[model samples]
Target: MARTGTRSTIGRTPPELWPSGGTLVSTDLLDDGSVDAIAVPLVPAVEGEHGAQPGEGAADVSALYGIDLAEIADRVGLTGASGESYVLQLPRAVGSAVQLPWQALPPRVVLLGLGARSAADLRHAGAALARASRGLGRVLTTAGVQGSQSASQAAQAARAFAEGYLLAAYRPPTSATGPAPAPSAELVLLGRDGTRVTAALDAARTAAAATWLVRDLTTTPSSTKTPAWLADQAKRLAARRGLETQVLTPRELSAQGFGGILAVGAGSASTPRLVVVRYTPTNASGRHVVLVGKGITFDTGGISIKPRESMVTMKTDMAGAAVALATVLAAADSGLAHAVTAVLPLAENHFGASSYRPGDVLRVYGGTTVEVANTDAEGRLVLADALAWADATLEPDVLVDVATLTGAAAVGLGKQRGALFGTDDALVAALERAGEAVGEPLWRLPLVEDYADAVRSDVADLRHVPADAGLGAGAITAALFLREFVGSRRWAHLDIAGPARATSDRHEITEGATGFGARLLLQYLADLR
Candidate 1:
């Protein structure tokens, strides 16, 4: 069943909510018209007031509650407020249902963990709350967060909170069904210093919503999210956002001589397309950042069939496309400093008589030829053409291509970290830093020159798959294939096969596609600007 909830906004509350050090203010007990919950500042003065006698040091919440930590979790979530001194760690975050009992309180007690919580941890916790309260119609009427007096830092936290909630709760309605569910509540900042923070958060929320809009379209099943249909979506978003847009059909690609994309998509009845979206800010003077996404809406392994289990999540093969489109939207909404360009190479890999076979050499966009060793390795083929086109035509300051390209990435990093490989160290460093700031973990993998030799074809310029069947390095080989097209352009390749889909049960996601790189790319672009 679909989960539902709401966040109510009804009262004017004090902004002095974040307590530095550790302090507590007790509310009037059981008053006739008292508020549902009160925000207590964890300041230093209250630490002594809570009871710290000489020779008898105070205890933490676990000891003060006089119960096991697990039991407390069972009762009221993870909020710890039993007259104990919690070492306030900057940006730390934790939650407890005890802070607000869902059944007893007017609304559930949603505690905001600030001290020990990293930005990513807070985002993770916020997403969890969205799921836990799904369909319950719970609202975040009050938020208790702590930080220094810096307005930007506070604003950063507020923006993070908003992005977390917005992305975690978004669900696109299935085409067979009707519209998506309505939002449950209004998000309001809890403290006084939130005026500027609120505005920053509002900007971030707008960007996140745009991300959801694009991701939903990308994640739709291939039966529905066809190349032409995806182009329609790009056109709609462009018209709405006032960005420049163009859609090239299979015939156009063939005429333009983009044989790699055309050849891979020839077997499918859906055909193929290349979507381009451009956003130029009014006062921007910086060079453009081009985002290329591999939009294989579905992959059936072409002439080479995949196992049933491997084919189940093929709908999300376009996750990179989702991020590409979402990044452009985010850049425009945030008024980023640089001009942005997004290129989505959309196609399908299916089996039919027309399907390209093994040993067939494909001449991609930049005149590079590739030997099709495995038709299932079609993502690289499409991206090779797209990347070549981007380099030769757009000639942006930097080129970034994101794709759910290889299973080897999943085997290496699991689902929490995305693997990044590139030719430019500075560009890679910027992405790494951006990933950390947003709580989206990214790791750099080697693109050894030795690996490139493995993909070299005896008959053509390159082979779709390496010569050795059992040898891994699939991610490296995919990146190597893409490198040929990038040429000398500053480029980075993100293999999101690991993080594109959640691997296990998490606080925010319960299976299905995760909006993995939307925030990372958004923040990275904003920073570059």
Candidate 2:
């Protein structure tokens, strides 16, 4: 329950659930006393060059003050290595010369390295500067503004920089240790012609705000985030963006025969819910995409419980649902022409007397029966019900589902990228391109038709888990099990077990749930035909 029309950041501060009221951005010229700090990019010296070279902002500084920044770089041993930074005191750097620009200047100037000037390198550079600017209120930066690149390339680079900055600024709400450092009040990106990259800047900010919301939702403790609670949040999300929301109660789910979802939630104190969010454009004339996410607020592995240490971070098991919810909201916020709908199956897999045992046969939507081999492999069960329901009822042209479904995904792909399994090559290529552009890379893992027999059950249509005594491809087997429900629809599956939560902060990822699929999915939908 939030008041309407607050006007903060992307679109209204969006209730207290989202801590970042979003940050205000501007493309105005530098004004003294208006900013806390300024970041100037320094291109490192090439093979035989003399010293570090100044980027757009540094060049402007040299022109305005009549000084040699290169000389200072040489004296200070500043090499423009990627992620390298040199701090310069504003008034002190100018020496005793006349400070002709204004009475007061920014307190500090950060000279950051732009190695190779590639998008990936610049994105890292932006994150580094943002992390360093922790205490500052307002900061101006030119980390990605290279004068030698084309207008389009410059705009792309600027977009990456702004996105990285906003993403790195996110800090989850905490109470154990006093107050956490607040995100910067405002961020200013310097454009070449004062307003040239304004649209790109705004788009980047909106997308980043969506990512922040996902992070907030995923990191919340399960003590507060239940299936019914997530349904309530759906209403809040629908209200913030002009969209439609619907919730299916336990009774409705039972009547509809969503056995997979109901079976997983039988052990938990809270009931299950299926939340649907839909977005239709003003002039709807594009391909329809249906998105499904696995929302397990807390996973205790049902009857087969996990180790105590393994359950510590289980609160973030709902990250995939967070990604889907945020991406659909972002599509509406950006006003994408394509019609998009998100189906989230919400439940908590707790261990209790009522939990489904290892040999129970549960029927999913569309009357597809599955044998429960191990209760821990519950993600695919819920996703199966949603995927079947969406394909049968939603009339979607394409289907995509995201989930933190398997530890084997992290074992195979490490912690950097997600595992992508899809039937359509063109759709897979589009998703890969979108992921590459957003720094959320995806590695394609085969659906391996030969391995399909491993999931077949002797007592049911399929077994949710593979044989424990023989085969090993857990991630692939899980995807193949989910594929059975798609029923010829062009679909893609994202197994984000590794990248969904970060073990340690790196790149633009925080220590909690990474909010992995939000940015990549939004980018894909934005560019969809």
Candidate 3:
């Protein structure tokens, strides 16, 4: 239900306005008049603790503004409790009476809880602040109040806070009832080391905005975002970002023998497309990394249709492709030195007279034959073609493929993390570190060599899926099938079936299109550089 012509905007503010490395300034030197709201972090009191007491931050606010924060907490039943938030409006007398920069005092003060003193807690606190400060124009925060941590830890906390705030502030309405509201708030970090905090904030904003782009693409209804539409988007992005783009049509696909993509997309009226996006920096490090994403714009499961209930959120099946596209663009925007390429195989698996049938033998791109067992396993087919193409042509140093491939992945990892399968331990370890650093957790699942037999075919080289429904290791079997394309190369497969779509709002993640791998992959590529 996205409004026509209403595209998601990226980097609304100019780069100059974005926080960056700069000279530090004292809190005393900052003009309070510039800030409409001031946010301070508070930790929870220990269990069985009684009367309201002033935390260090509250004490600082009390002395700075002449407001008794402890008394206010007592009256309002706030005990510096975990996950609790309280806001106080300062009267003109107290607001203007501050000793330092009395004329520049903020009118409102916010107390946010740091529950458990964990990273998750800090992110939630930041999300809460973002929701509360929706209408406020300029906000300032004191890094010292988050916790007694080192400079590195403080920068991390600041980055988390900024990410949470910006991501939670996003609202992509489906209805075109009125013009979308403009962003009202601007963030300012109050600390001694402006350069460090600025760099952290800038990085967080870039990463989060890229995530939002993925969310926008995935959340758009399938009807509006067909395979051609996705190709157009990639072309536009490439043009704007100075990346190289190539989109192959159905005729070209047939000529090149991309049977996997052609077979899966044959059912739909919209033809299939394979989009290649490359970012080659000047004098690049020569570390070629290829990323392949399953771009099923919509999945009706072809002839093997899903249940009515199961089809509700199937529009998110292309989340992997969206992440891939967003990751490459973000890397280019950040001026990374590594050479990156994204292969996106775009298609729609629909049910029609022309739909490819079961038991059909498909000679995939690299001349490997595959027997179609379950049409619902179409994501792997498209991904297989791109993987094979990358392997044959790109000769990448590291190859990664991402897809919302199986429900069994959700059954195994739940929605908290994606299932990662890889041949190289070093690549797997690096991806895990990146995922962890960006809060997109990935759990490594073994590519059981024994499970390779599950996908073996009687007539062809392999089967699209196991013939037996009761067979276990569904996620593993899918990964093994992809491994057939990339032989002896460092490869990793991310089955993001569970984490691609959010079941409910949590922390900085919205209720749809979680943008799972965009930031993780970008972080991984950045680490390589």
Best by TM-score: 2
Give me the runs in candidate 2 sitting further than 4 Å from their true place.
Answer: 1-31, 62-78, 90-103, 175-180, 193-196
RMSD of each: 8.4, 4.9, 3.7
| Residue range 1-529, candidate 3, lDDT tens digits | 4422434443233111234222113354236456677766666566686544554345666667766666667677765543456777765544534644223577777776666656666667777777667778776665233446677887777777677777776665443555765563676655425567667777777887788788878987887788998888888877888889999999999999999999999999888999999999888866988899999999998989999888999899999999889888888888878888999999999989889989999999989999999899999999889999999999999999999999999999999799999999999999999998878999999988767888999999999799887888899999999999997789999999999988788777878888899989988987884
Q: All candidates' TM-scores?
A: 0.80, 0.90, 0.90
Native-vs-model 2 lDDT?
A: 0.81
User: Each model's number of backbone clashes?
Assistant: 32, 0, 2
- Give the 10-residue window scoring lowest on summed lDDT in candidate 3: 14-23
Candidate 2's residue-wise lDDT over 102-195, tens digit each?
3355666777777777777777777777777766777776667655777778777777777777777777765444465466536666543324
* lDDT for model 3: 0.79
Residue 91, candidate 1: alpha-carbon lDDT: 27
Candidate 3 ranges beyond 4 A from true positions: 1-34, 46-57, 74-83, 89-105, 116-118, 143-151, 173-184
How much does candidate 3 score in TM-score?
0.90
Residue 121 accuracy (lDDT) in model 3: 66
Residues 186-218 of candidate 1 have per-residue lDDT tens digits of 343444244676576666676566556545665
Best model number under lDDT: 2
